[model samples]
Target: MFIISLTYKTSLENVERYIPGHNLFLQKYYDSGQFIASGRKEPRTGGIIIANAQSMNEAEQIISEDPFYIHQIAEYEITEFIPTKYNENFKIFIED
Candidate 1:
């Protein structure tokens, strides 16, 4: 699993301009089952994405495809983790 944190480097006006494109990017990954969940952070600073990429390389590649990354709208911080325990329904997103 990966916790993809995004911190805005630019103004909200700039971020809003790319949100539509960003939503499309997110939908593409969601359709591929790579993105588990994503949303804006409180105080509206940036956003977070819970992704199910198999490795750090894969995760980085995924991030590379984001409009935010391409436009340098935000800084990315990716943290990879092992899910020791999760809800039974969440097993579908977990890998052995």
Candidate 2:
């Protein structure tokens, strides 16, 4: 599933505060092979995370760990995506 997370900043400090949690969460997912792809949205806006998980419950577990959730720094739209024809070479970015 692909989870697209967005943030509405009440203050820049809130955004800063949320960084730690986001970093930790991303590290966990990326390290665990759950994150297929992720990056900051354009104009340095929002977050886009592509995840592969066993179930929605597992996905939620990943979401709950994000720093944005801890600081209330962003809002997210978590959705389940069925990739019809994902380009393996173009889309895949697995760093070892």
Candidate 3:
């Protein structure tokens, strides 16, 4: 899995302008089963996305399709991790 962390590079106004398109991009990935979960940060500075891509390159390629990335409205930091232990309900997202 990959954790994509987005930090606003411009202003909130700039970020808001691309939200609609960003949402659409998110939906596309969700429909394809690439995205697991996503939402805004606590202070609303940016957002986070959990993705189930096969590799770092795949994750980056997926993120490249995001509107926020296209407009350079935010900077993305991707962290890859393996799920050692998770809730039974969340097992569907984990691959052995």
Candidate 4:
């Protein structure tokens, strides 16, 4: 699993301009089972994405296709982690 953090580098005006396309990009990945969960941050500065990828390279390749990255509207920070423990309801997230 990977936690993808997006920090806006540009103004909201710039970010909004690409939201539609960005959403489409996100939806495509969600449909493909690459992205599990995603949403904007509390203060709306950026967003977060929980995804499954074979490796960091694969994660980067997936993120590279995001419209936000393509337009340089935000900077991305990816953190990879192993889910060793979680609630039963969360088990699905860690399953193979």
Candidate 5:
């Protein structure tokens, strides 16, 4: 799993301009089962995405397609992790 953090590099006005398109991009990945969940961060400075991919390279490629990245509106930091423990409801997230 990958935890993708998006930190806004542009003004909120600029970010809002691309939100619609960004949402569409997110939906595409969601439909394909690449993205597990995503949403704005507290205080709305940026956003975060939980994604499932074969490798970091794959995750990066997926994030690169996001409108925020494509338009350079936000900077992304990706962290890959192995889930050692979680609620039973989250078991599917760790399973291959």
Candidate 6:
């Protein structure tokens, strides 16, 4: 199943500050077949991340690992997702 994570940063500044750490985590996870994609929201709010997990509980646990979450830079509102449509060539969407 998929999980849609809606993250709201305490401030875009904080988001930026923690982005590098969080990004590395996302990259490692995605490469290992955990997170599919993760990036900042349009206008620079926080980020929207799509992840593949065995269960909602696992998804939540994964979200908890984000540096932003640990540093109090962002708060995540995560939910189960059914991604019926996806663009594999968009460069942002990865099955992993």
Model 5 stretches astray by more than 4 angstroms: none
lDDT (Cα, tens digit) per residue for candidate 2, span 7-96: 556666657766776788888888988887787877766778888876788887778777786566777788877666756673554322
Of models 3 and 5, which has the larger lDDT?
3
lDDT of 6 by residue, 1-96 (tens): 565555664766656777679878798888977776676678776667777787889988887887877887777777776666766674444344
List lDDT for all candidates, in order. 0.95, 0.74, 0.94, 0.94, 0.93, 0.71
Q: What is the lDDT of residue 1 in candidate 6?
A: 57
- Model 5 TM-score relative to the real fold: 0.95
* Per-model TM-score versus the true fold: 0.96, 0.77, 0.96, 0.95, 0.95, 0.76
Show where candidate 6 strays beyond 4 Å: 83-96
User: What is the C-alpha local distance difference test score of candidate 3?
Assistant: 0.94
Segments of candidate 1 deviating more than 4 angstroms: none
Q: Distance (Å) between predicted and true CA of 4, model 3?
A: 0.4
1 or 4, which is superior by lDDT? 1
After aligning candidate 3 to the native by TM-score, how far in Å is the CA of 56 from where it should be?
Answer: 0.2
Q: Over all chains combined, what TM-score does candidate 6 have? A: 0.76
lDDT of 3 by residue, 1-96 (tens): 999999999999989999999999999999998899999998999999999999999999988988899999999999999999999998988964
Q: What local lDDT score does residue 74 receive in model 4, on the 0 to 100 scale?
A: 94
Better of 3 and 6 by TM-score: 3
Clashing pairs in 1: none
Please give the clash total of every predicted structure, in order.
0, 2, 0, 0, 0, 0
Tens-digit lDDT track for model 5 on 1-96? 999999999999999999999999999999998888999999989999999888999998998888899999999999999889899998877887
Provide the global lDDT of candidate 5 against the true structure.
0.93
